[model samples]
Target: MEPLGAGDPIRLGPYRILGVLGAGGMGKVYFGRDNTGRTAAVKVLLPELAHDPHLAQRFLREAHTAQAVTSGGVARVLDARIDGDDSRPWIATEFLSGPTLDDAVRAYGPFGADGVRALAASLAATLSDIHAAGLVHRDLKPPNIVLTATGPRVIDFGIARPEHGMTLTTTGQVPVTPGYGAPEQVLGQRVGPAADVFSLGAVLAYAATGRRTFDGTHVAAVQYEVVHGEPRLDDVPAELRHLISPCLAKDPAHRPTPEQIAGAFAPPQGADRIWRTGPLAKDIARRGAEAARQATLVGREPGSGPSRRRLLRASLAAGAVVAAGGGAGAWWLLREEPRTPVESGLASGAKLLPRSTAQSGKAPKPLWGPLPVAAKPVDGLVPAPLSLRDVVVFAAKDGGLAAHFTRDGKEKWRLPDVTPAAGLHPLTEQLFAAAGTSGALRVHDASTAKLQWELPDADVGRFLTMDDENLYAVTRGGQLLAVDLTMQSIRWTKPLPTYAVRGAGPRAAVAGVTLVLFGDDGAVRAFSTIRGLDMWTIEGQGKSGSAIAPAVVKRKDSNGTSYTVFLGGRTLKALKFPGGNEVWKAGPPQNGTDSWGAPLVHGDTVIATNGTTLAAYDLDGRQLPLNGRAARGPLPATPLVRQGEALWAVEADGRGVSAYSTTDGARLWTWSAESRGPWGMSGAGNRVFLVNDGKLTAMPTVG
Candidate 1:
C-alpha cells in the first residue's frame, strides 16, 4: 500500500492529514493518521468549492448524516467537525482497505452474478445502515462503491443527506450527471431512499458490464438521453436483466428502495453471489467435493458402478440455475453431465452459464451479465418498494384509481366511492369504470382520499378518460356510459359490440358530446355519451385482447383530420376520431418486454418507456433523439411527470420507488431497497402511498 504524499503532517478537522487518497468533482480525500497513528480517510471540500454554499453545506450535511449511521457497511466515523476556518470543512472516517468498483471492474472485467449478489448485499446493508440513521446517499454510482478487505463499503457521502430543502437547478442550472441523477434531482424535488435504489441499479449495471448506463460522449447530451432513453438490454445477461429493470425506472415513486434492491439482489436466489466468498473457485470446489462424496455414498464404495451412476445422477441434477424468490436455484436440468471442468455449459436448461474457474471460454463473471433491453418475460418480475408520498390510483381490482392512503402499515382509506370499477388505465389521471364493477363515471378527489361523485354503473368500467369535458365508460357487453361532470349526471348509455368485447385499449373517448368505442375485432362505434346517438362506426386494427390504449382525440387539422392516438404493444397509431380513418401509425412503445411503466403523452410529444429505455417522438412518427441512448423503465407503474424546476418523475420498478427527470431523461436520484415494487405506487398532495398483496402504506413527502 502506497502512502499519500511524503506523509505530510497537516492538521485539518479533528485529525491529522498524512496523505491523500483521491479527489473528484466534490473534494479531496486525504489519508490521515490520527493522534494515535491510526490511518483514516479525511475528505475536505476544495477551498474554491467551500466558498459555495450548496457545495459546502451538502459536504458537511453528508458527513454529519453519515456519521450517524453505525453499520458494518459504513466506514466508522472517527471524528468530524465544521471548524473555525472558512476554507476547511472536513470529516474523517476510518481508512477503507478495498478497491473502488471502478478498479474492480478494470482489474477483473465485468462482475458476474456472484459479484452482483455480493455487491447488492453489501450495498443493501450499507443503505440499511444509512436509512437507520435517517440519511440517504443521493449519489450512489460504481466509482463510489468500494470493495474492501472486510466487505463492500459505500464511500463518498458528499451528497448523502436527508431529502429536504434541495433543488435540482444548480446555480439555477439543470441538474448535473444527467443519466445517474433521478427526475427529482433534476426537478429539485425533495428525495428520499428511493433515489439510492435507483443509483444502486445503475451502479450494479456498471459493475456487471464495464459501461456507464447513460454513457454518451457529451454530458448534456448524455443527460438528455438518460432522462429519456432506454437500456440496451440485449447486451445484458438474461438471468440478471429482470433485476436491473426495477432500479432504472424513470419514476422515483416506482423505483425500488435500497432495501428492495438489496432484498431482491441479496435474496436466496442470486444472493449467494453477493456473499464475500474470498476464494470463489475454492468454495465451488468444496461444494463439488461434497457432491462427489454424496454421489459415491462415501464409505460404501471406491470405484463402484453404483458410485458412477450416482455421480452421473448428481451431475444431471445440477441442471441450470434460476432466480428464486430472492436467491439462485436450478431452473431446469440441462446436460448436467459432469464433464472434466473444461467444456462449455451443456446447453440444456441453463438460464445463465454454469459457474466455472477455467481461463478461456470461462462463464461471464458472477455479477456480470448483458444489459437489460426491452421487457420480456423472465422467471418472475417482483414489485418494487414504495415510499409514502406517491399517488396510487386504483383500477380494475376495485375502481378508477380511487384515492387510497396508509400509515405505519395501515390504510387510511380504500374507497371505491369515486367512480365505478374502471379498467386499469395509465398515463392519464381521468377515471372511468365498467359495469358489474361500477359502470359509473366516478370522479375522485386525489387530495382528500374521497370520491367527489359517481355517474353511472351501466357501462361497467370500460372507458375512463377525458377530452376537455365529459366522462366515458364501456362494458365488455357493448354498453357505453357517459356523463358530463360540468353539468349534472343526466347520464347517456348506448349499446354496441354485442359479440366479442375483445379490444379495449384505445376504445372509448369523448369530445364535446361525441363518444367513441372500439370492439374486439377492431370495430369502432362513434356516438354521443351525452345524447345516446350514433355518429360513426369502423373496423379496428390490432389483435383482440392486445393492450388497448386509451383513445385520445385532438383538434381538427386543415385537411379536416381529427387525430386520435392508440397504443398496442410497441405500436402507436393516430386515427381520425368520429370518422374512424387511419391517419398514421408509429412503432410500438415497447418491443421484447412488457411496458411496466406508464406511457405518457404531453402535447405533441408522446413519451413512453420500454423494458430498459425511455423514448420520445412526435405524433407524426418522428424520432426525438434518434441520436443517443435512451432512459429506461419497465418498472411496474406510471410515472408522475412534474414539470417544475426540471421535469421530474416517480414510478415503480419491480423492486422500489425511484425518481427521474423528464426534460432530458437523467436519473436525478434513487433509494436502495430491501423490498419489491408490487407495493404499487400511490399517494400525492404532500404524501406518498404504496400497497402490496398484504399491506397498505403511506409516507409523507411535503407535509
Candidate 2:
C-alpha cells in the first residue's frame, strides 16, 4: 500500500482516500475506502503535527488513546475527528491485511517450536488485551506486530502510556526501541507492565532466534547492551526458553505476566483455529482478494444496494444478536424462589420500616416494596439502582435513566438528559453506560432506551469502572478512559498524573487488574489494568485530602493474589498487587475511621465506609468488630459488599436498608419506607438496589 501522494487529502472524514498506508512519528497512513465497502486504516495528522495546538492536543490524544482498545488482538479504532476549536484530525482503523511480524520473519526462516508457541499464544493474547485495555504496547517491536489472517494484530499506538499517565514526551526524551528496550526502558526508568513484559520477551526473542535479544554494533552499542545485557537466549527453545526467560527479566520485578504469557503459551486446540496457515495462508488470501476487488471498484458510485449505512450496520448486528439471547449475562439476576418479602405491614400510602436482629436469630425480609414508587425526592437524590440486563437502571434526578422491569416495576425505557449521572455503568449485558458531571459520555440501549452513543465534551471522571468489555474513565482532564463499551469505541486513553502546578486531582480505582491513584500529596499511583503501565509509587503518602477510594482485593489465600486496600493518612493500607509492595499498615485514627470512599474487598474482609465511619479491616490490620453502631452519615452510594447471607446496603438508617453480619457485624434487616431521602445503594444479582428520594427500589438477597 503506497501511492496517494501529490499532497494527499482526497477525503479524511468519511474515508475514501486510497493508497499510502505507512509513514511514522505520528503522520500519514491512508489506504481507506468506506461508503460500505469498508476497508480502512486512515491515520493522518502531520502538517507540523496538524498545525500544532500543542501537537494537535497530542494528536487528538492519539485518536482518543488509540480509540480506547477493543482487541481481537488490536487494530479496530474505526472513526475519529478530534475537534478542539475547528478540526481535521483523522483516525479510522480496522484494516489489518498482512505481513510485518517483521515482514513474516524476513520471509520465513525462524519460528519453530510450534511456531514460537503460536507466537507466544498470539502475542500473549495481544498483551492481554493491551494490558487489559489500560494500554502500554509502548512500541512492541517487529514493526508493531501485524501478521493477520485473523491472528496477530497489535499495531502502533505510537508511544502509548497511561498506566497511570505522564509524559507525552519532553522530559529527557526516551520513547524506547534500543534493541527492544526494557531495563527500565533503557534506564529512563518508570516503564511498566514490566516494560511490556520486556517487549514480550524481545518479541519472542525475535521469533525464535533470527536474533535481537540485545545485539549491538550501533545505537550506542544498543544503549549499552540494554542496560548491561545478558539476553541472547542462544537460539531460545528450551521449551521456549522457559517462557522466554521470564520475559527477559531484568527485574521489572522479574517479568512474566501478560497473564503469565497467556498461561505459558496456550494455543493448541486446533492451534489458532484458522489464523493463517501454509505459505502465509496463501499470502493472506491473495491479498484479501485484491482488496475486495479494489473495494467493489471503489464502491460503485452508481446505484447502490447495501448502504443505508450498511443497512444500519446490519440492523445493529441483528439487534445485537437478538438482544444477546435475552438475559443472565449476570451481574446478579439469580433466583430459586425469592419474591416473598414485603411483610412488615402498613398499606395505603405505605410505611413499614422495622426488622433488625440476626446475631443468629434471623429476620431479614422485604425484597421489593416496603412499597411507594414515586412522590417526592427525584432531585434530592436516589441515584444508585442500575442492575442492567434484567433491567433496573433508575438514575433520575430529572437527568433521566429509568428502565425498570426487574420483574415488573414495569416502566422500561427513559434515558433522558442524563443529568449528573455518575453511575449506571455496566457496559454490556446489552450495553449500559453513563457519566455526566457534564462532560457527558452517555451510551444506552440496554433494551432500547435508544441513544447509543454521545461523548460530548467527554472529559468525564468522577468515577466509573466497568469490565465486561471496558469503560473505566477518569477525565475532567486527568484522562484515563479505556471505553469500548461494545464499540461506542475508545478502548484506551491514559493521562492522569499531571501536577506541574495546579493541585488536587488523583483518586481513581479499578481493582482486578490494578489501577490505583491516591494523592493528597501522600501519593500512591499503582497501575497495570492489563498494561496501561506504571505499577508502583508510594511517595510521601501523608494522605492529602483523603476521601479514600483505593480498594482492590483478592487474597483468599493468595491463589490469584492482588491487594492494594488503602486509607493512608491516618493509615490503613494493603498494597501487594502487581507490586505496589507495602503488604499491611494500620495506624493512627482507627475507631473514627479516617474519611473514606472506596474499599469493599470481602472474603478476607476489608469493607469501609465514610457515611461517618463503618470499618472492618483484617488483611492484617485487624479491627473487624461492629455488632451495633457503624453507619453515621454518607457512605453506601455503593461499596457495601458480602452478598450471601445479606450485607448489601451496609447500615443506612435514615430511609432504611441496614443488613449486616459477614460473620458478626449483626444488624441483619431494616428495609424502611415512607419515601424521600435514601439517594443510592447497589448490589445486583440476589438484589438490594435502592434510589429513594424519588423511588427506584428492589430487595431480595437475604441469603
Candidate 3:
C-alpha cells in the first residue's frame, strides 16, 4: 500500500484510511484500519457516482451482496454507509494479503498440475457457495481472484446478480471484462451462472498457461473472438484440460456446474497448508504482519476470529441486541444519546392548590418539579396515567420501571428501587405488576408496596391492561393472559394467531366485561372476561396496530352495541365489541400530515391527530364540525383527553398545547410551553400533566 494523496479522506466513520489500494471506474479502494484493530479494504465511490441515485443504489446493492456471502472463500464486507447526501457510499471488507491471481501468475509463471488442481477446487468451491446463495458473479476475471495463504478467494462483487432480480449494468451500459467475457456477456444477452462458469474457465486457463484463451488487441476484437472463436488450452495441464474445456463451452447449457468441477478436483492430502513454504507464502506473511502492526498502532486489538467479526458487523448494522453466553447478558449497539436535562418550568417546593382553584380564575401554578426524585431520567415517552390512590404512576417509555408521586408533587413510592430493568408497571389503581426478565410475573399492592401474588411461570409481559376485577396482559410472544386478581392466579391464556408487530406499540383494551386484543396481523379479537371464551374476531386490512390501547366506545343506538376503535397503519376502524363487526372507518389524512398518534376518545367524539392536523369523528364515524386550524406543529404524542375536550400536543418543534372542543371542534384555549417533542401527557381532575425532555410541567385544564 502507498500513501494517500491530497484529495483522500483521512477517516471514514470510525475507520482511519491509511493509504490507497487501487482506483476503479466507480470508486477508489483504500487501506483502512478501524479502532477495533481490524484492517479493511475500504472502497469509496467517486463523488459523481455517489450523487447519482441509480448508481448509489447499485453501489449499495454491491455492499449488501458482498455482505451476504458468508463463506470463508469470499472476503467479508465489514461496514457500509450508503444513504444520505454526505454519504460517500463506501464498503469495508476483510483486507486480504498476497497477490491477485493475474499478478502472481504473471510474476511467477504457471502453477503446475498439483497447484492447478488445488486452485481449481478452491475457486470452484467459492463459485459453488456464491451460486448456492442465488448469486452469479458477473465478473470472474483473474485480477478479482486474490491468492492468499488460505486459498484462492474471490473478491469484488460489484457486478454480482442476486436472485432478487438486480442486474449489474445500467441502461446503455455493459459490465464485462474483455478477455474473460463469455459469449452471452459479450453479446449482452441473458447472463447467469453459466456465464460465470465461462469466465472461471478463462481465469483458470490463464493461471495454468499464463495466457488468455481467446486473445485480441482491442475490446471489440476480444468480444468478436469470445463470441465466435475459441482456442488456447495448449499449455493447460493435460489431466485438467478436459474439465476446463467443458467450462468454456460456448453454449452455456453445455458448461459444467461449479459443483461438478469441485467434485472432480478434490483437495489433495495436506492441502490446507498448500501455500506454507512457497516464496509467495513468505510475501503473504510479510504483508500480513505489516498490516497487523498497522492495526495495533491504530488502537484495535485483534478480535476472536472471522466469525466474531461477522457477527459484530451484522448485529451492529441492524441495531440488534447481542445476547451472548446463552442469554446471560444483552449488548445493545443502539444507544439513545443521553438527553441533556431541559430547564424545568416548575419551581422546586411549589405549593399545590386545591381542585376548586379553577373558580378563582387563575391557572394553577406548577406544584413541584419536573418531579424531583433519584431515578434514571425518562428516555421513552410516558404511557397512560396510572392512578394509584392519591398518586399517579410514571415510567420510562419501555415500561421497564415506574415512579409514583402524589398530586402535591411529593414522592410516594417507587418500584423495587429505580433500576430500568425492574419492568414494574401499574395493573390497577391499587395493584402494581412486574414481569421479570426470567418471565416471572409478580403483583404488588400500591398502598403497601408488598407482593400480593406471583405467577412464576408467566411469559414476559410486554404491556398490561386491567379492569376493576381482573388484570389483562399481552406477553412478548403475543399470548393474551388474563390473571384473576380475585383468585390470585391466571384464569386462562390464549395465544393470538399473530401478536403485535415487532417495533410497533402494543394495543389492547378491557372494555366493560369484554376483553379486546388487537393482533399485529391487523385482526382484532375479543374474548369473554367471565369464561375466557373467544367472543368474536374481525380481520382488518393487514396493517399493524398502534402502540396505544384501543378506544372502547358504547353506542347509544337501539342495540346499544359497544365497539373497540383501533388505529392501524394510516386507517382507523371501529370493531363492534363482543360481535367484532366493522362499524365505522376513517382513512389517513389525504392532503396533510402523515403521522398519526393513538386516537383519544372524549365524550362522543373520537379525536385523532395526524401530524399537526387534528380531526374529530363522532360515534357514527361522521366528521365532527372541527374547524381545522393548525396546532403549533405535528404532535407525535398521544392526545391527552380531559373532561370532554382533546388537548392536542405540539411538542416537537413548538412546545405548547391546544385544548379543542371535542363536540363542536372549537379551539377552547392554547397554552404555550417550552418542550422538546416526544412529550408525555396525562390528566386528572383540573390538572393536565406534561413531561417534555427531562422537565415536567402541569397545565390547568380550563386555562
Report the lDDT tens digits of candidate 1 across residue range 253-347: 78776677666776455444432453333333333343333322412422443332222222221111100000001100011111121111111
Tell how far residue 643 is off in model 2, in angstroms. 18
The lDDT leader among the candidates is 3
If both were scored by TM-score, which would come out higher, candidate 2 or candidate 3?
3
Candidate closer to the true structure by lDDT (higher is better), 1 or 2: 2
Please provide, for model 2 over 419-482, each residue's C-alpha lDDT reduced to its tens digit, 9 standing for 90 to 100.
5335556554355667655777876666567766677766665444654345676666766776
Q: Which stretches of candidate 2 lie above 4 Å from their native place?
A: 1-8, 11-31, 34-38, 49-94, 97-119, 124-138, 141-149, 157-171, 176-181, 186-197, 201-245, 251-307, 310-703
lDDT of 3 by residue, 303-388 (tens): 63322222221212111111110000110001112122211111111122333453343334454456533223333434444444
What is the Cα-based lDDT of residue 374 in candidate 2? Answer: 37
- The top-ranked prediction according to TM-score is 3
**Model 2, position 187: C-alpha lDDT score:** 63
Q: CA lDDT, every prediction?
A: 0.47, 0.58, 0.60
TM-score of 2: 0.29
Q: In candidate 1, where is summed lDDT lowest over 10 consecutive residues?
A: 319-328
